[model samples]
Target: MVNAQQYIESSFPKHIYRIFAIGKNLEGHLDLSEYPNLVEVRLGNNPLLTSLSLGPSPRPYLTAIGFRGSGITNFSFLANLPNIHMLVLVNHTQEHQAKIVRDINQVHQCKDQEIEKIKQQIIQLQQQIQSLKTCENSNRNQNSPPNLSSERNNDTS
Candidate 1:
């Protein structure tokens, strides 16, 4: 059961790629900016952790992140890691999971609505373009003079 002070006191190698601090008592923020090559991080079972801060800079190589059984409530730190593909949030209570799911669904719904609005705007622009083409065709027909050969035949008849 490593406490926050012990974990912070320990020095990690610069080239370390993966970290598994399970059951460790981590508190406040955990900055891993020193490990530029880090790829996978698993910090589950840390009930003392309230918030996690990946780093001041972006972690381009980070792909997998897990935080099961932790007391973390805010996940806004994930927005910085664009390459993350796997996220684990298991071991939480059923009620917590339900709330998280509801929040995710709301965000998904807003995104879907925004996409539909953009699609409608595109359709409206296409219709406007078609109407302009039709108007231009009508104007060209009205402005052009009648054929001279047909007029001459009419006069002779």
Candidate 2:
């Protein structure tokens, strides 16, 4: 049998600091634990992407992760990740919850201000890190590299 994991470990660039493959048609699980110098990863909006695992190698340097619309619901791998600073997990899996919150907000006008404050708190809680880059649904070029600061999703699969 072909050891896909070993093949990926040997083939992927060891010194890579980032992996931005946003809006690609990628599916299934992705484990990126070989590279020790990784600092960021942005894999948003594949919609089909189920699982993602990172660290135990790049745990110290890995700081940012953006998986806005990948459909990944489990983040247990990041429970004790100390160096991590930024995490953007919105859309799809969170859509139902957000919808419920919005509906409740509309119905409970008396608690509008309190609900607004709670929403801010929720946003702050989700964004544990500094630089956040997610969901550029307007223009996503899946043919090139990403320039997140400029709001471009040019990441290829």
Candidate 3:
């Protein structure tokens, strides 16, 4: 796996978005920091790899990050990935678990803003429909029963 780093360092691809490494050890994980084009990376079932740093890339396209059964302890490395939206931190202590959830919620306020916009749209539409119904009912009630004089004029026309 270390040799792969030498190969990657020599020639790096610029179009790759997703990378899946199976049965790869911690030695291979070092190359990820060098891959500037990586968006989605899956390095599951690696027993040796514990701590993960997001590294120097802006990580703008990086969204969902999953770490299941990696035996990781410190989650401070996540602070580097500022644009991360959805994160799954499995097999962590209660304190670390709570911190991940809290930090993510603080970073993005989209959930709250979306709910507020929906509420406002609903209220505005409801008021418009109510006004229409009021106008229709008022017109119906004000119109007297069909008069014979109006009926004769309609028949002549």
lDDT of 2 by residue, 1-157 (tens): 2233343455558788887777766677778866667788887886767777775433767789888887676664563344667877677556655653454345355356678999999889788533233434323445457667566444432
Where is model 3 more than 4 Å wrong at Cα?
1-15, 22-31, 102-157
Candidate 2 overall lDDT versus native: 0.65
Question: What are the clashing pairs of model 1?
Answer: none
lDDT, each prediction:
0.77, 0.65, 0.61
Which residue pairs of candidate 2 clash?
Answer: 85-129, 86-129, 144-154
Model 1, span 53-94: residue lDDT tens? 776676768999898988788775665565677878998878
Candidate with best lDDT: 1
TM-score, one value per model = 0.60, 0.50, 0.48
Where model 1 places Cα greater than 4 Å from the true spot, the runs are 1-26, 30-42, 52-64, 76-86, 155-157
**Residue 140 shift from truth in candidate 3, angstroms:** 64
Q: Which portions of model 2 show Cα errors greater than 4 Å?
A: 1-12, 55-58, 92-157
Better of 1 and 3 by lDDT: 1
- Give the Cα-based TM-score of candidate 2 against the true structure: 0.50
Worst 10 residues of 2 by lDDT: 130-139
Per residue, candidate 3 scores C-alpha lDDT tens digits across 1-157 of 3333443344446456666553455333334565556667665555555556657555777665666555455565555565676666556677878877776565455556778999999999999999999999999978958679989999999
lDDT (0-100) at residue 107 of candidate 3?
44
